[model samples]
Target: MDLNSSSPQTIPVVSTFSSPFDQSPPVKDPNSASTRKPISLWPGMYHSPVTTALWEARSKIFEGLLDPPKDAPPQSELLTKTPSQSRTTILYNFSSDYILREQYRDPWNEVRIGKLLEDLDALAGTISVKHCSDDDSTTRPLLLVTASVDKIVLKKPISVDIDLKIVGAVIWVGRSSIEIQLDVIQPAKEESDDSEPVALTANFIFVARDSKTGKAAPVNRLSPETELEKFLFEEAEGRSNLRKRKRVGDRKEFENGEVNQLEALLAEGRIFCDMPALADRDSILLKDTCLENSLICQPQQRNIHGRIFGGFLMHRAFELAFSTAYTFAGLVPCFLEVDHVDFLRPVDVGDFLRFKSCVLYTELENPDQPLINVEVAAHVTRPEIRSSEVSNTFYFTFTLRPEAKATRNGFKIRKVVPATEEEARRILDRMDADA
Candidate 1:
């Protein structure tokens, strides 16, 4: 499987058929009157499923991001690690010192002043971050606070933006709701005189979305997210989530590769077959007619950094499987899981690779969408001569998802088949119940 000596070519085998892919919508024109038109999403796409899976996996992805156990210890004497050192803490700062001013209300001139003082005391107790602080003062934890959209964004940049003027800001806990806080950090420098050199501080709370249809709008604070705030800013780490790494294998030589050339790689393909009978079949393929030029590869691809990158070959295999599945299903396919990968040989960057997919099973759980099971595989395509070495293989599950009409009940899977009978049999069964 090491691909050091020869060039490579990619072949796309599928047994399926499909209508032309509908193009994505054009970008909105700023000056056009049509700007008010509702934005429409692609009828069927795989991104939603991917997002759902990723969100579910968020905890594992960030497990190493922060120090654990935010709850108070039974006794203060038992503590060893500091609470403020956890990675999840966020910071907040406030500059305005105006007291909860109901002081100037018209009716509050004489007798009304006492009533106003009582009302103000009640308000402060209700709106302050005291709930986030330890009631017994037995435990002291770290605190990161934020209020206002700009503060958090300027501190930590995510992919999108939220309007601070309308919504404010907060620190997000794993799967939990976002919590807002109030806090300050003083400058490191000190003044030469006897006076204190600390700077002034300011903080604000976020406005909640009224309903799904309503955007957030800023308002005077009547309630603050205190309990959740303590968990996020005081109990968590001040750093970002950590990442994982993958290791690679050594490369092999590919001699006199013909199919490995870039000109021969397959683009995509389609065919026709029954919706049932896919699970038992082996070695699935695509209908050649729908495919274009075969993919090509050079010898340099085989010996990648002395060892080939197994991950890249996995991608190549997935591309072929998805393309073939898309043709048969007639819609975008979602990769639900990559159950396992067996790397029998190293794959260089230049080694041409071929791919195939077969339908495992499918059935209608609901009338508007069809659930299908697909299997994918990859192989080395260059250096035509053979030795004891075998082609590498991988396995993945895919759902050829459809855009169900709002009122429709179930989906109808399209007919797509590979050239061979055995391959066709494995990819036709449209059966399996929803989880």
Candidate 2:
């Protein structure tokens, strides 16, 4: 069946009621399948049986890593796969009777969106591996790593009491890159005629690399059968093009010393520096709102390929961004959307990782719900060499809690002002991207 057919395809939903870590003790018989322990899935609100099976099947990649084969098949021998072939669904039963609701509920009785982001990354990885896997499992598996997250938009607030499901599949594929699209949906209640509403949509891009050589590896071509599938493929292609154009434009702008609206902002910044007392009392300097955290990556946080997991980085970055927004807004901050995330370099297990976050800007167009943009840059520090390199950059948007405006009298967020030329340039760059 076509994944994007007009009629909804029947997806095999795997419930998250049983904990993957709660399996029974291994049997005495060596030949019995129960004697073998199942590959443990990451602890989370949702888990797909299909993904688990895939992981178990590909577990031999670890052995191959130690002793790699001499010859490998060429890219031309790979099979062409359809979107439906890699489609998967994971169900989160958060109804009134289910015990799983407590795990996902926040203090405000709403679903925790940060945890969901982590799971989305995991699910996207599963889809990518499923699309790139071949029939011959004896050979080594490709090392699929997350290249970037194009965008994740929140369409509606997710309630903790409703049943939810996440469906995802490969929407487009290139020479060595694959784009996966995921939809988080709230299923309709029993006896209701309403349709399932999508609460969030996410697009993730993954790149395949040879396990032994650590070079680019080819992936199966995606064949879109239905009109919807074709349209999505084309849309992803256009987004890829836009990203390339943006990079080129940014380089040219910097080379030509073009600062369109930044000149005025620079002048304003200089004036603020010259006369500190004349600045607006209701505003705060962007530099003063920074928060930083540092830690050494551990083996427990590594992914299947023995590298730091991308989801772990995202989870930590998001927590810091939330804290930055909360401090800047002086109230509880709610996650609005993840604008974009770029994985520039892979972080190692023992790398000293530092996460620095600050409030980049704020939008007060809506007085009741002020929007705040937070940026987090992850850097790997090497004290021996006295050098540091950025491994990832994350951009997140947040807002104040809805009740904050009603509870606090004359409540307003202080405007964030840039005091340095670099800060001014950052603000202008964000504005141009939004435009």
Best by TM-score: 2
Per-model TM-score versus the true fold: 0.30, 0.86
| Window of ten residues with lowest summed lDDT in model 2 | 1-10
> What is the overall TM-score of model 1 with all chains considered together?
0.30
**Cα error, candidate 1, residue 112 (Å):** 63
Which ranges in model 2 have alpha carbons more than 4 Å from their true place?
1-37, 41-76, 96-99, 188-194, 254-260
Q: Assess each prediction's global lDDT (C-alpha) against the native.
A: 0.30, 0.76
What lDDT tens digits, residue by residue, belong to model 2 across residues 65-100?
333456754344678999998887766656633556
Candidate 1, residues 45-162, lDDT tens digits: the string is 1111111122122312112112223553322232122222111211111112112122212221111111212222111112222223223332322221111111111111111111
- Ten-residue segment with the worst summed lDDT in candidate 1? 158-167
TM-score of 2: 0.86
